[model samples]
Target chain A: MDRSQLLKGLLDIIVLRVLETEDGYGYQILRRLRAAGFDELGDASVYGTLRRLYRAGYLSTYVQPSESGPHRKYYALTEAGRKYLHQMREAWEDVSAKMRALFDIAENGTAEKGRA
Target chain B: MTDTPQKNTDIADYRIAVERHLADLPASIREDLLNGLEEHLAEVSADLKPGVPLSHLLGSPEAYARELRETAEFPRENAGDRFRRSMWRMADPSFAWARGTADKFTGSAGVGEVGEFGRTLRPAWWVLRGFIAAAVVTHIFIFGNDSLREAVLSTGFFGLLFIVAIALAFVWLSLRLGVRAQEWSRRSRRLVAASGIALVAVGMLTFSWVADGFVYYREPVVGYSTAHDVVDEGVSDVYVYDENGELLTGVYLFDQHGNPLYLGDPWSCDDGRVNNPFEQEEQESAVPDPFAATTEPPLDEGRYGYRYPLCPVVEESTGADDPEQPASEPSEEPADADPSDEPTETPSRTPTPDPSAAD
Candidate 1:
């Protein structure tokens, strides 16, 4: 299966993890994610994801009021976001275990026996 | 941004393009997307050569919008969006611009001029708009007793209709003011500013100066505490105010010179909303103009006397402080005060059902 579909949903968690370290701005967050080795990540994707989280009360925001052609919008995690991250981590662990078992069984000749 | 017209137009063009695609999105999302896009564009532009366009760096505006749409995790599941969608259902049919209205502006020469003029008049339009918005906000949050609010808040089947109607009018005006001012000339901009100032002045005048400046000072009129006394004494009076600031009880209805009021009939629509007026009936004519011919002539005939061949015209010089006007205090006329000398004095002072209107 193409991992892109799987990665799409997990990107939100990855973004939250990045924010968990320190509050970052749009372009900064995108840079941090790229540095963390999600080399294929798109700029619009990261920014859009941040907006989605911020709007849903998963993140709190304030303007930097920077003197610029454009003002920087800063995003930080909320208490709800912290609670949410814990639940997502547990759910991820469960999914991770189930996938490992499936991979191991398929590698063992169980897949060939089932086909016969 | 302190950019040159060249740079500003570049960004403006980009913003407009992005907004065009975003017309169907929620306002909050569109705004966030724009802000993020703006900052990103600015940062990217900083690294570019002076003559390079943003499109050269970011690729097509259409592609950017599509990328944002696909990637952004919009909060589409919220109840707020549901409510907004419903409000749109009510507002859109009446106020939504036709698809080609914008294209028509650029396509036609005559329309372009009219559109430009409308944009020039925007500053004035905004003042009146601000007043309306403030009025609605105050009505909802500050005063439940306001009549405009009451009309909207009326219970039962009709109330929904009233609420919908008010909301429609509000949305229509806002949507109608879509003309952007970038293309307007400096002279046109100044005209807009001047008209805005003029409107504000006129608005201030209505607070107290209207009706020929009759409400020059606070009247020693009746208030809620004295409502019983007014009704018991049977004074069917009328009130005219500039701004509906206070239902001021102590208002004098005549000009400083105490000439009979040259004011119009009381506006009862916005009246009696917050405070219960002493009585809840239509105000009787304050001026008794016997030969005024029309059922309602303005109070300005300011008569110490009239020279009619048949009818006597009262031309009494009574400003607010006419000394013998202890006589003006009572609702009834001093039967001896010559009618010709004081035209319509008593009716103006006392709030009484006009005997003439009955006729």
Candidate 2:
């Protein structure tokens, strides 16, 4: 299984979570994602996710003129986006806890079988 | 931070490449996908080391576009789309190279400015397209029999005004459509493009047909009229003579206007005895013998002018007496009488002897 394939489903939630803290432009959001250890994340993937989220009313954009370069279009999370992100967080926690419990049970069972 | 002009162009080129890949999508969707792409590219470029190519860091433009499309949840490619994509893939390299060469040449030759100047004339193209569309429509629906030019020309002042009004309406609609094209669905935009191509094709064909008609009408009619035998009296051979009663050989005849006088069959010997097989078979019950030697007339050296002594074999055999024989053979009694009456008379006498000899 490809890590990117796994990342694809979570991209929406991750992008939303990133914007939840503060407003960020395309490159800024990408840079934050990279710093968070998504080294394999594609630049277009983030941009595309932002566009999808913006179209879905989960994000809103504003053009801020920069002094050095071109004008930056900043993406901010909407109220609905925050609520959606909260639900995703809960779902992620629930799945991870179940996975951890399963892993522990398997490990203990293997240890007992080896001793016998 | 402020970037150099070269960097800006690189970013723009990359963005354009990506946009071209996503061209199949609806304009609104495509625009949304690419909205902040330029600024994003710039920011990425700002962090890059000097002299590093953008592709080295960002991957191929094609891959970027693919990733973008996939992430955006744009509809998956169907078989038709896949086939079209494969075809494009085959042609893309050469097309890209040609485009790059053209861009370089234009940039170096100052033609890029001319291109920019042409971009400003897009509205003119739209207006011309409208006029073409109107002409095509009118030609098809209103004046089916007439060529486009004739239809337009024959139409009086009011008709011209009506056509102009129709063209203006088309222009107005085209302008409105162009303004809102970005909001239209992909299918509708494709339909418009296909119609535009169709209009242009029809306009070119009709205009070219009209142009050919104009050329055809302007041509001199005399050439066509005199292309075959000038005299319709079925004179298959012309024999000319001087005042000394001597038959003239290689004498070229011309009309009063200095145009070459072309008379007779010019190919077959239809002098009274040696008949054209087809005509003889048709007229008389004479079944032409296939093995019988039919004399071939002298080749017309002067292709335009009528040359004298059309049948050289007959001329050589009978000498000056040949003219009288051909003239009187059709009328059996005249043969015997013509020889005795004018043995030394000019060859012109032969023409008057037998009126039916013209056949």
Candidate 3:
């Protein structure tokens, strides 16, 4: 499966999380995502996620003119964005915990069958 | 940060292409989506390697726009909107084909070099478009029915300078607009495109008018000689007389350059009607008499074939006329004659040379 396809659903949460610590512009946010090992992330995916989040009132933007370059529209996580990120994190943990427990039970069942 | 003009143009062009793909979206939403795209693209370009293209780093503009659209969770078009869009697509089948061909060509190898070369020429096209736009605006609003040449001529040197200044202003305005057009709403963009088409139409009409003016100014007026010695005071007929007071016939006159001296309207002798001097066709040879008119001339070489006295008549009244008296009489009679009657009286008065001599 395409990694971008897998990352599609999580882009909003991932982008919100990236903006949590510090407000970042499009290219800078994309860079941070790359550093976090989502190397196959498409450029437009991050931008679209930011747009969606901003539209949903989860992110706020401000224009920060660069000293050496063009002005950048920086995206910061709003109060709503932070709360949403927290909920997403909890939901992700809940699903992963359940999957881990199911995998352990399956492994034990396979082992018992081997013993039989 | 240190982007060259070419780099900036490339980014601007890419951003516009992406925006074009998003034209179906709500204007507010599309504007919001593209608000800071230019700066973002510039940053993206800054991080690229020296020769790396933005499209190479990202994907095709269409794919990028699609990804953006999909990931943004924008509402899909209704069936009716989809149908209308498909109909539009069908209406411009050539546009689609050309776009596909361009995409394929750009995707192939060696396009980078070509693209880079083409990028260098973008500024020149922008400048030319600005000039044409300025010319159209001035021709319509400022110059007011004056052809471009006439406007320039009437305006004189400083006015021309002012016009150039306006064109330069337009160039600056166009360059700025071209860069920022990606941020405009679709409606505004369409309005601009429509105005652009209108401007081009006006420019072409003005250009043709200007071209015709140039042709008119350059064309020499027929029957009016530019030569230094040729008399331009409407000398309709040349009456040459010998020193012995007899009318000269079958005479041919030439200047020092060996070119036959063409004086007056050669067609004036027939039907008492002169041809329109501006008519492009060369005049027929001078007819000796309207009753005896023929296509073939009595003399073979010259255009005005008739000898000096086009209407020759045998002298009836004066058996022997003084040459000095006839010569002096004509000069005074022509000066006193009505200018309108000169051409008609010239042919008829050939035989009556002694009227003043008899007086």
Candidate 4:
């Protein structure tokens, strides 16, 4: 599976999860995501996703004067955004468990068929 | 973060490209996106090695803009934008000139300023204004004295107006685009502004002489002449002047019942030119003059005195005694008739009789 394709669906959730801890500006958020091993993540794409989240009311942003750069916009999860994140995380876990169980059953059934 | 010169230029270039792709976005959305992206770009550039293209960091500006657009709220296309599009597509440059003019009057002259739709009409009106201005200028030059019927039906003049307006639109559009593309410096822009002010000052100075013609066209034709004109046209030696001394031409009169009385337009004459009413009344008396020369065809004079139609204003509304008595007495007063018996105060005309006039 293409990592970029997979990144598309998870980008919003991943961004919300990251911002759930603390508010982070554009470049800082990109660096944190990269450090967390999204090595192939497109830099501009992540910024676009952040903007979408903000517009969607899943995140809120405020400008803070920066010491090193131009004024930076810090994005954080809104209350609505937190609710969305919690709901998506539960759904993801349920899907993940179901898939894992299906894989386990298939493996065991194949071994039994070989022994018979 | 402080951007190096190279970084700033790269960011600018990136933005320009993004803006080009995103030009269709509503102004508010476009501005917000650009401002946010500018700060974001500045931050990213701080950590990048010098000379790395922003395009390298952001894929292509078009793709980046598309992603942002997908995320941003796109309000529906409004009537104003739609109208703007129609004008630009239908008749460019001239309509564009029209647009600028319309914008100047968006909230002016009792027009309700409905957000964008209202704004759209301004440009279209502005475009039509060019045509109107052209028609007016044409009217002054070619049709100033023409009767209304001839002016409206003159296809040649209308064609000329269309051609002139289209030509002007072309020149205006070229100048506008040229100034924009060249990004004229502030000093040059000031020179243009100074020239415009100078032109306006010149217009203000010369406005009075030609202003009457414009007003004459705007007003109803009935305003130009007076009812006295009819009496003057019939009698050659006699002339009509309103109490104010303006030779009453095509003036309207109303009887005590408010019924319209048409005396026709006064015959235009050269001599005995009374321009103002407050001037010496001795020279202004509308009564017939023995020496009144006929500027038109030969007119006959009555033997007894300079004869003129004695038009009297009767206000029967005051319940005065038979109004015919007063109305007849004044018409006979004539230009040189004895004023000794005539009451000087017009308001008292209703109350006073012959004895009051002697007082």
Instruction: List candidate 2 stretches off by more than 4 Å.
Output: B74-359
lDDT of 2 by residue, B1-359 (tens): 67887787888889999999999877878887787778788878877776676777789999999999888864446779878977987899997888777777767877584457466666776777788878777777667756665666677897788778887898887767655764799988788768878879889997798887765543322442442433344555656433333444444444434444455554455544333322333423453332224322223323334334444343333234664544333344424433334434432332223433323
The pairs that clash in candidate 3 are none
- Tell me each candidate's TM-score: 0.36, 0.39, 0.39, 0.37
Alpha-carbon lDDT, every model: 0.55, 0.68, 0.67, 0.58
DockQ of 1: 0.26
The runs of at least 3 residues in candidate 1 whose Cα sits more than 4 Å from the true structure, single-residue gaps closed, are A1-5, A65-70, A110-116, B1-9, B47-52, B73-359
Cα lDDT tens digits, model 4, B183-277, are: 68867756655654554455455455578776544332232244344334453223233222223121223223333333333233344343221
| Residue-level lDDT tens digits of model 1 in B44-156 | 56545677787886667786677677766464656877787669867886555653465476547554644575766765566465565544544445345576556555665
Best-matching candidate per lDDT? 2
- Looking at candidate 3 chain B, the ten consecutive residues that score lowest on lDDT are B287-296
Query: In order, what are the TM-scores of chain A for the candidates?
Result: 0.82, 0.94, 0.91, 0.90
**lDDT comparison, 1 vs 4, better candidate:** 4
Q: Is the docking of candidate 3 incorrect, acceptable, medium or high quality?
A: acceptable
Cα displacement (Å) at residue B89, model 1: 34
**Model 3 vs truth, CA RMSD:** 24.0
Residue-pair clashes per prediction, in order, are 25, 0, 0, 19
